[model samples]
Each structure stands twice: as C-alpha cells, then as structure tokens.
Target chain A: MAESRGMFFKSAVVASYALMLAPVVMVIIISFFRQEIISFPPEGLTMQWYVNAWERREFARGFVTSLQVAAIATAIGVPLGTAAAYALARAKLPGREAISTLLLGPLAVPGVVAGTALYMFYLRAETWLDQDITATLSGLVAAHVLLTIPWTVRLVTASLQGMDRSAEEAAANLGARPPTVFMRVTLPMLRPGVVAAALFSFIQSFENLELTLLLVGPGRTTLPVAMLSYLEFRMDPTLAAVATVQILLVTAMMLITDRFVRLSRVI
Target chain B: MAALVLPAALLVFTLLVAPMALLARISLNHYSPTELMVEAFTAENYIRAVADPYYQQVLATTLGVAFLCTVLTVLLGFPAAYWLARMESNRKSIATILTLLPLLVGNVVRSAGWMALLGNEGGINAALRALHLTSGPLQLLYTPGAVIVGITAVVLPYMVLTLAAVIESIPRQAEEAAANLGATASTVFRRVVLPLSLPGVAAGSVLVFILCMNAYATPLLLGGPQFKMMAPAVYDQFVRGNNWPFGAALAFILLVATLVLTVIGSMALSRRYRG
Candidate 1:
C-alpha cells in the first residue's frame, strides 16, 4: 500500500508537469513545421516561417514598442514603488494599512476590468485636456506603471520585513546621516529585492495584453496585442515563430531572475 | 515619509480608484447613441444586465467556469506543490523553473497552442483517428471545456507556486514527529499535513478563482463566439455594442462578484481548517 501510494503521487506529479509543459513544447514544434496551416506531425520541416516572422515589419515594430513601453513603465514605477515600500516598511505613517491596501489594490483587480476602467478615465481626461493620450505609448506606459507598482512595493516591503534593521541603526550610531545610511547601507541590502521587483515589473508590463488592447490605437500595438490580431486574421507558422521568440525572451528573463534572486523567494 | 508615499498615493487615487469610481457612477447613467453617455441617472443598465436571460447565462457560465478551474487547479496543483516543497534545493530549483515557465509565456501564445491542439484537425483528433477511436474530428475547441482546460493550464502554475511557498514554510519536523508517534504515513498526511496546508490551499484558491472569474483572453480565444463569458460580454457592450453604461455595469458586476466570492471562499476554507 505504501509503495502504491508513492507511485500514485509520483505519477500524478509527472502527469501534471507534462500537462503544464505540453502546450509550450507543441508551439515550439509547430514553429518548425513547413505547412502553412497548424497541424501535428508536420509534412516537412523548414526555417522559412522564422524567416518570414522576422521579416514582418509589424512584429518587429511591436517588439520594439513593447520593449520601450515595458522599460519606461519599469523606470517610472520602481522609484515610486521603492520609496513607498520604504515609507511603509520603516516609517510609522498614518493610515498605513489603508495606504498599503491602496497600493496593492491592482493585484486583486482583473487586468481587463482595470484596462476598461482606465480607458474610460482616459476618454474623460482627453475631453478635459483636449489632447489624445489614449492610444499613445505614454498612455500605455502610465497604465503599465499602475500594474507594475504593486509588485515592486509588495516584493520590496516583504524583503524589508525580513531584513535586519540593526545595520541601519549601527550606521546611525556612527554619526552617519539618514540619507547617507539609506544610500550606503539600506539600498545595498535591498539590492536583491529591488532587482527581483524590477524584473517582475518589467515582465508583467511586457506580457500585459488586456490593458494594452483597449488603450492601443491603430498602428501602435504592443507585441501581445499584435500577436492577438495576427491570430484573429490568420493561422500560420509565423505566429508560432513569434511565440517562440517570446518564450525565449521570457526564459532568459526568468533565468536572470534566478541568478540574482531565486524564484521561490520572490513569487 | 510623507513625500515618499504621496506620489504613489496620488497616482493610485487619480488613475486606479478614480476610474473605478467613475465606472461605477457611469454604470448608473443612461446610454446614448449620438452622445456616447448622458449624465441622467438610471439603473437601466443594471436592470438590463439582471433581467436579460442571455446576460444571466453569461454570468452563470462565468461563475461556473471560474469555480471549476479553481477546483481543478487546486487538486492538480496540491501534489505538484508537495513535490516541490519536499525536494532538495538543487532539484527544487529545476522543478520550479519548469513549473513557472508557463506563467512567463504570454496567455495569447499559450491559448493559441490550445487552439492548435484542441481544434478539429488538431493533435488530439490526429491521434484519435490513428488509434481508430472515432471517424471524424471532435468539437473540442470553442467549447466551455476548452476554456476550462486552457484556463486551468494558465493558472495551475500560480496555484502551485502559492501552495509551494506556503508548504515549504511548513516544517518537516511536524510530519516527522507525527510519524514517530506511531501514526501511519497516510494518517499523518491526513490529520497533520493536510490540515496544516489549508492556508496555502485557501490562498491559492482565492487567487486562481479571481483570475479565472475575470478571465478575458483565454475565454475569448479558446471558448470563441459560441461561449460568451462576462469579460468578453463586457467588452462587446463597451466596444462593439457602444453601450458604455451597460459595459460599466457589467465590469463592476464582475469586480464585485469576484471580490465577494474570493472573500467568502477564503473565509470558508480557513474556517473549515480552524476547527
């Protein structure tokens, strides 16, 4: 009975892992298929689709646009988030719970709901300002910053909670000013947490689709939005190729994240 | 401290809270074709959403699919979490990478894979025909089942990761102590291990439930036109149908439903384990 139970759980784990990975493996394999349509057991193998996917201007533009947007969003979000995390973690601010809750509110919200609500807000804001921000990269960045900040604050705050505060106090005892202690000691200690937060914020911003879809205008689509539109119009190995590149990028990002801070610690 | 927190607070208030508040307010407004939205207050949109049978079905389907996905994820994910939590650090690192890779990939790409694998001329059909299980292709894609499968696959990593984090925090000494006290392995797992892991299960369930409830992309791509869930229906109302009030109502409805159910679920699960 003991052996049987062990076997049962072992097989269950293996099956679950296989199920989790099968789709990704299939997409990669499909990318190599020569056929125009998607089917298992390809008629032949070819690299032509990858070539075609590379040559497509929209995919390239979308890739660059997503990169720019994710970068800008992360840039804007990190400082604000880190500052807020520091305040919440170290300082005894009034209404701390409320502030923390508000900061972390985006994590609870559905991206589609948040995206739609923001689209409406932007529409009204445009009416007041008499300028279009909605479909532009700036609008996309702003929305992404909202999505990314919570991750930074949450991760950084958690790390701060685990950190030893004696180091900061020791620097203070040595006549180091507050700013000097923060810059030299506190910031260095928070490096792993901050880096992990930045990585997560970047990846989340890059993979964002629902929020980007509503705000994205004609000719200014993010990569996921572009891939979605591509799939809507056609079914080909080009998408398979595009997805392969995405998988590769995400893999590299995750690997880098692992090197700096383990995934188990962060997520 | 005030300066540090103010920028983020202002951003959240202006961008996040204000918009959601406005969305709620607008859901009570009147819709107009020529003017987009009229300031006149009315509950007509909410009434329409509640009264319409189609909308009712959509809400039901949305709730049903989310519930199913949450349940399935927890069931499949618990063992995976167990495996990861018990593994040596070296093997645990590798397993964690494999498990989280799906989360790193975009949802559209993963759903697209499902579309290929579950379609009429897809992989399953090819294999079935080869085995002579059936003559023609099965209608697997564009169904509620496909959405469930796709969403489950997408969210499983989340459930597993959440549970693993919690389960790993559980000290092995407790289980060892239970075993040394003459409890059988299964009994220890049942009375001690399972009860202790309830918090993780509760948390993972809530996270997965909320995600599955407000799902947009997987349902759109996999479930297709025939099956309309709340999110896609809200999209249709706002974008295609041009009814901002109705869409706003649906969005709030989804948000409320998700929040209420998640709170209730976590409470219920935690309560169960507390006793």
Candidate 2:
C-alpha cells in the first residue's frame, strides 16, 4: 500500500506539471495552425498567423515601445538600485530595516493602485511644469523604473550579502581612494549581481501591464497592452502568434543568460 | 553609504511615496464634472464605498476569489514542490527551468491562452463532446470558476518556487529517520516533513494570496464584465467613469486589504513556527 501510494504521489505531480504548462504549450501549437478560429484539433499547420502578426503596424510600434521602455528602465534602475543595495547590506545605519522596507514596499502595492497613484501625481506635475507627461514615453519609462527597482534592490542586496568584502578592504589598505576602490575593485566583484539585476528588471518592466495600463495613452501602448486591446476586440490566432514569439524570445533569453548566471539564484 | 543610497531613495520617494500620498489626498477631495477634481476635502468617497452594497459585493467577491485561488494554488503547488525538492541536482535544475517557463510569458498572453481552452467550443469542450461527455458546450469562460483557474495557473509557480526553496533546505536524514522507525510513507510526510515545511507553506501562501488579491489581467479577461473585482472596479471608476476620488478610495481599500491580510498571515505563521 505504501509503495502504491508513492507511485500515486509521483504520478500526481507529473500530471500537475503537465497541467501547469499546458496552456502555453497548446497556444504555441495552435499558433502554427491554419484555422481562423482558436479551437483545438487545429485545422492544419501553417505559418501564416506568425507572418500576419508581424505585419500589424500597431504590434510593431508597441514592440518598439516596450523595448525602449524596458531598456531605459533597466539602465536607470540597475545602478541606483545596486548602489542602494550595497549601502543597505554594508552600511551600519539607523533605521536600516525601515529604509529597506520602504524601498521594497511598491512590490506589495497592487499594480492598479501604483498606476492610479502615479497617474494622479503626473496630472498635478503636468500643470506645474506646464507640460503633459501622461501618455509620454518618459512617463512610461519612469513608471517602469518604479516597477523594476525593487527587484534590483532585493536581488542585488542578496548577492552583496554573499559577496566577500576582504578584497575591497585590501584595496582600501593599499591607499586607493574610496572612488577608486569602488570603481576598480568593488564594481568588478559586483558585476554578476549587477548584470543579473539588470536582466531581471528588464524582464519585469517588459511584462508589466497593470502599472502601465493607466499611464499608456493613445498611440503609445506597449506590446502587452496591444495584445490586451486586440484580445478585447477580437479573439484570433494572431494573439497565439504573438504569444509564440514572446515564448521564443524569453526562452532564448533564459538559455543565453543561464550560461553566465544561475537564474534561480537571483529569483 | 548615505550618499550612495540617496539617488534611489529620492526616486522612490518622489515616484512611489509622493504618488501614494497624493492618492490618499485625492480620495478625500471632491470630484467635479467640469474641474475634474476640486480641492475640497471630504470623506464622501470612502463613505460611498462603504455604504454601497454594490461596492461591498464586489469587495467580497474579490476577496472570496482571491482566498479561493490562494488555497487552491498552495494545495496544487505542494506536491509539485515536493517533487522538485526531492529530485537530483541535474534533474532538478532542468525541471525548475521548465516549471518557471510560464512565468516568463506575460499574464495577458497566458489569460488569452486560457480563454481559448476554457471557452465554449474551445479545446476542452471539443474534447468533452468527442467523448460524449456533454451534448452541448458547458459554460466555462467568464465565470468565477474561470477566474479562479486563470489566477491559480498564474500564481502556482510562485507558490511552488517559494515552497521548494524552503523544502530543499530541509535535510533528508529526518525523513529517512522517520521511515527507519517503521513509519509509513504517509506518516513520514505528515509528521516529519509537514512540520518542518510549515514555514514554506506559510511563505508561499502569503505570496500567492497577495498576488491573487492584486490580480488584474486574469479577472479582467477571464471573469468578464459581470464579475467585478476591486482592481477592475477601480480601473472602471478612474478611467471609464472619470471618478478619480472614488477610484483612489477603492485603490486604497485594495491596498489596505492586502497589507492587513499579509501582516496577519505572517504573524500567525510565525507564531505557529514558534509554538
């Protein structure tokens, strides 16, 4: 009975694993089908949907926008987040715990609330600055930065905690200035953490929707928003095609990064 | 060190803290059709949110669905997490990557996939009819059930990963000792493994619960318009209804609910661990 129960447990896990991955796998398979309707036992195989998805003008624009936003957000977030993490991990300061919590608090806030709050702030700023930022690329980038920074702070802090600090001390003992020690010794040691943080932040920014939903104005929708709008109006294999592309892109990113970094460690 | 931390501190303060404070302030302000928002203080938005049975129903449904999703994800996640935690290192690495694969895709795309599978005349329905299970398509998508399924699928990986991390930290010798004492497999899990893994369950539950509570795309796409959740309701109020004050009020209510539950859950879990 015990052996049979063990077998049952094993099979149950395997089945759950399959169930967990089924939707994405099925979507990819369906994307290759020639059917117009998004039903199973697809009509036949064809690459037309992929071709059609790429041809849509809005999709291309949204893809570009998403890339721009992710790139800018990561670029700005990583350095500042890494520096802050370094201080939090290495510095002995009053209220350190409170400061850390404050920095990571956005992760707990619902994305809708974050977006709404930011939208309200931007509206006030629009009048003060005599320039409308809502629906602008810079506005979107700023929100993405808010979304991505916590991941960087958390991951980089973890990495810094595991790092050896003797090298930095030795460099300092060698009469190197603080800036030089940071630039030459400390920065190199923190490279892996920094890179991992950047990759994670970029992915977070790219996948983000709730925070971006309120802020994305007309003609500036990100890829996910575009997909959302398209799905809202019509359900088609085109969405499946877009999903397939996304799956492939992420797979390639993971495979490439896995060579240099253990993705599991950062998450 | 203070100087090093200042840039990020400033950014988060201006962007995160300031905006949230603005939200709180605006929630009290009066909404005017012509002015958009008039700088008059009042508790009318919060009062309206509390007094309306419609808002209460939506809040209850949102919390109910979130609770159900959290429970379901933890239950489903535990077995998979056990498997991953027990696997050999090389096999574990491959399996872990495969398990996290769904997370890499955006939630919108994932929800779209579910719409295909769970919709009437979709894959599952077609399969059911082929096997003569039902004469006509059963209502699947756009129900609370669909929302639960979608949210569970999205959050399951998070639960599994969190649990697996904790479970992997547990030494195998404890399980072996229980088994060596003639404990049955079930007893070995129940007594030895379960107690040690409570921390994982607690952590995963908290994480999954918050994610479910804050869910946006899953409910919006899967639950449809008839099923109202706080996040979507907030969106409708702010964007579609043009009621900024009420929207801000709803947003705070959602945030407060998430914070209170998380704090209470974590405290309870920590107490359990201590006891």
Candidate 3:
C-alpha cells in the first residue's frame, strides 16, 4: 500500500510538471506553423514565422533595446547589490535590519505601484535636472536597475550569511588589504552567488513589462512591452514565435546556470 | 560605498515611499483631471471606495480571486514539494530544475501561452469538442477561471520552492523512527512530517496571497476589462479615468491591506514554527 501510494504521488508530480511546462512547449510548436492566425494545431509546419519575426526591424530594435537595458542594469545592479550585501552582512553597522529592509522593501511594492512612482520621480527629475531623461534609455536603465538591485542584495546577503567568516579573517591577518582580501579570498567563495545574482538581475530586467511600459519611448520598447502592444491590436503566430524564442533563450540560460552553479545557495 | 548605498536608498525612498505619500495626500484633495486647482481636503474618495456598492463588489472579487488562487497553488504545490523532498538525489535534482523552470519565463509569456490554449479555437476547446465533452468552444478565456489558472501557475513554483526548503530541513531520522515503530507511511507523514512542514506551508501561502493581491498582468490579460481588480482599478483611475486622487487612494488601500496580511501571515508562521 505504501509503495503504491508513493507511486501515485510520483505520477501526480510528473503530471503537474507536464502541465506547467506544456504551455511553453506548445508555443514552440506553434511558432513553426505557417498559419498567420494561431490555432490549436498547425496546418503545416514551417520556419516562416521565425524568419518573419527575425526579419521585422521592430523586433530586432526591441531585442537590441532590451539587451542594452538589461546589460546596463545588470552592470550597475550587480556591483551595487554585492556591495550592499557585503556591508549588511559583514559590517555590523548601526540599524542594519532597518537598512536591509529599506533596501529590500521594493519586493513588497507591486510592479504597478513601482512603475507609477518611478514615472512620477522621473518627471520630477527631468524638471530638476533640466533634461529630457524621462523618455530616454538611461531612464529605463535606471528604473530596471532599481527593480533588479533589491533581489540581488537579498540573494547575495543570504549567501554571505551562510558562509564562514574565518577565511576572510585569515586573509586579513596575512597582511592583505580589504580590496585584496575581497578580490582573492572572499570573491572566489562568493562567485556562485554573484553569478546567480547577475543572471537574476539580467532576467528581471529582460522580462520587465510594467515599469518598461511606463518608461519606454517610441524606439525604446522591450520585447515584452512590444509583445503586449502587438497583442493589443493583433493576434498572430508572430507572438508565438517571439515567445518561443524567449523561452529557448531563458531555458538555455537556466541550463547553463544550473550546470555551473547551485541556485539554492543564492536564492 | 556609503555613497552607493545612499543613492539607491534615497531613490527607493523618494520613488517608492514618497509617491505613496503623494497618493495619500491626493486622495484627500478634491481635484479633477481637467482642473488643476484643488478646492479642499475631503474624505469623499475614501468614502466612495468604502461605501459604494460597485467598489465593494470589485474589492470582494479581488479578494475572492486572490484567495482561490492561493488555495489552489498550495494544494497543487504540496504534493510536488513533498515528492521532491523525499525523492532520490538524481530525481530530486531534475525535479528541482523542472520546478524552477517556470520562473525563467516571464508572466507575460506564460499569460500569452494561456491565451492561445484557452482561446476559442485553442487546443483545450478543440480536444473537448472532439471528445464530445462540449458542443462549442467554452467561454474559457477572459473569465475569472482563467485568471485563477494563470495566477496559480505563476505562483505555484514559489510555493513548491519554499515548502521544499522547509521540508528538506526536517531530519529524516524522525520519519524513520515513525516508520520503525510500525506506523504506516501515511500515518508517519500525517503524524510527523505534516506538523513539521506547517511553517513552510504557511510561508508559501502568505507569499502567494500577497503576490495575488498585487498581481496585474494575469488579470489584465485573462480577466479582461470587465473583471476588475484593485491594482487595475488603480491604474484606470490614474491613466484612463484621469482621477489621480481616487487612484492614489486605491493604491494606498491596496498596499496597506497587502502589508497587513503579510505581517499577520509571518506572525502566524513564526508562532507555528516555535510551537
């Protein structure tokens, strides 16, 4: 009876996983269809959708825009998040809990609220700085960085908390400066967590829609935002094609990260 | 180092906190979108949100959907989490990877996938028709059911991840002891594992509840314009209705409600953990 029950549970789990992953797989299959409108089963399989999706200048522009934004956001967010995590973890600073909560509080705020607030702030900043930064790529990058940094800080802090302090102390005792100790002894240990954090930051920026919607200009739309706008006016196999590409890209990244790093340590 | 922290901290405060504060203030002022001049402070917006039947219905629907989604995720997630925890190492790693795979794809993509699946000519309807389960394409998309399914799918992985962590922390010896005492596996799980894993169950439920409350995209895509939630209601007030004051009020109320529930959830979970 016990063995039978275990088998039942195992099958249930497998079924649930299939259900969860089915949508992405279905999207991928649909993307190969030659049909202009999306339907249950493709009339015929072809690579025309991919060719069309890839050839669209808007898609290319959006992809490049998203890449640039994500890259810049990750560049800023990773170091800042790592520094914040290091300080909160090792510094024993005053009001550390308060500081930590403040840093991570954005997680509690809904994306809509964050977008609205950032929009308001950018408007104010534009007026204050006397510059049209509100509709620029730099503004979008800053907003994405803001959203991405908090998660990085939390993940890195969790990793740092679980790590031993003795190695860093030993390095310090061996006449190494703070930078040297961090570069040689501490960083190597923190590599998995750092990489995981960077990947997360990149993905967060890449997939962000709400904040991007509020901040994106005519030529600065991200893929998700572009998809959303397209869906609003039209429904076609093109969306399926874009979604398939996104799924493949993300799956590839996940596979690489899973092979090289342990997500649990960072998350 | 301090400089870096200071800028991020200031941005968070001004951008996150101040706007909500502005929302609160705007909620108190009687102003229109066309007219910039604010006449006087009033509780009219709050009263409308609280007293009106339409707003109340909207609030009820939002809470109802969020609760249903949270319940569904927990129910579906627990078995998967338990299996992952108890599985062999190779099976465990694969299950872990599979469970986390959904997070790699964004909510928008997942929602779009559901749109294709649940639409009029979608796979499910076609299959149902062929199987004689229904005569016509069921009005599945753009309904509360779709909203629940979409949100539940998005939130389930989080539930599993959280509960798996908590379950894995339970020492295997306790379960072994129960089994050695001639207790059946189900009995052992009921008496030993279930109680120990309640903390995780609570945490996961709380996270799901808060996320569902704040969710915008799933409802926007699946629920359509007719199925109104507080977040989108807030959006409409600001962007469409051009009533920033009322929108601000709604945003504040949503934030407060989510915060309160989260706090209560943590308190209950911590107490359960200690007990």
| lDDT winner | 1
lDDT (C-alpha, whole model) for all candidates? 0.88, 0.85, 0.79
**Candidate 1 off by > 4 Å:** none
DockQ of each: 0.70, 0.67, 0.52
- Which candidate number maximizes TM-score? 1
* Clash counts for the predictions, in order: 0, 0, 0
lDDT (tens digit, per residue) of candidate 3 on B1-275: 34446656675676667756665666787866579427568988888788988888888888888889888787778888887777777666667777777766887788877788888888788889889899978999899999988888888888888988988889999999999999998998889998999988988998889889878778888887789888778777756687766776777777778878778878977887787
Q: Which candidate is the best by DockQ?
A: 1
Worst 10 residues of 2 chain A by lDDT: A257-266
Which residues of candidate 2, in runs, are more than 4 Å off? B33-35
Candidate 2 per-residue lDDT, tens place, B132-202, comes to 99999999988989998888899998988888888888999999998999998899888888889999999
Model 1 residue A260 lDDT score? 80
- Clash pairs (backbone) in predicted model 2: none
> How would you order the candidates by lDDT, starting with the best?
1, 2, 3
Compute the interface RMSD for each candidate structure.
1.4, 1.5, 2.2
In model 1, state the lDDT of residue A151: 95
Q: Show where candidate 3 strays beyond 4 Å.
A: A1-12, B1-7, B36-40, B265-275
State the fnat of candidate 3 relative to the true structure: 0.35
Give the per-residue lDDT of model 1 (tens digit) for B209-233: 9889888888988887789899888
Worst 10 residues of 3 chain B by lDDT: B1-10
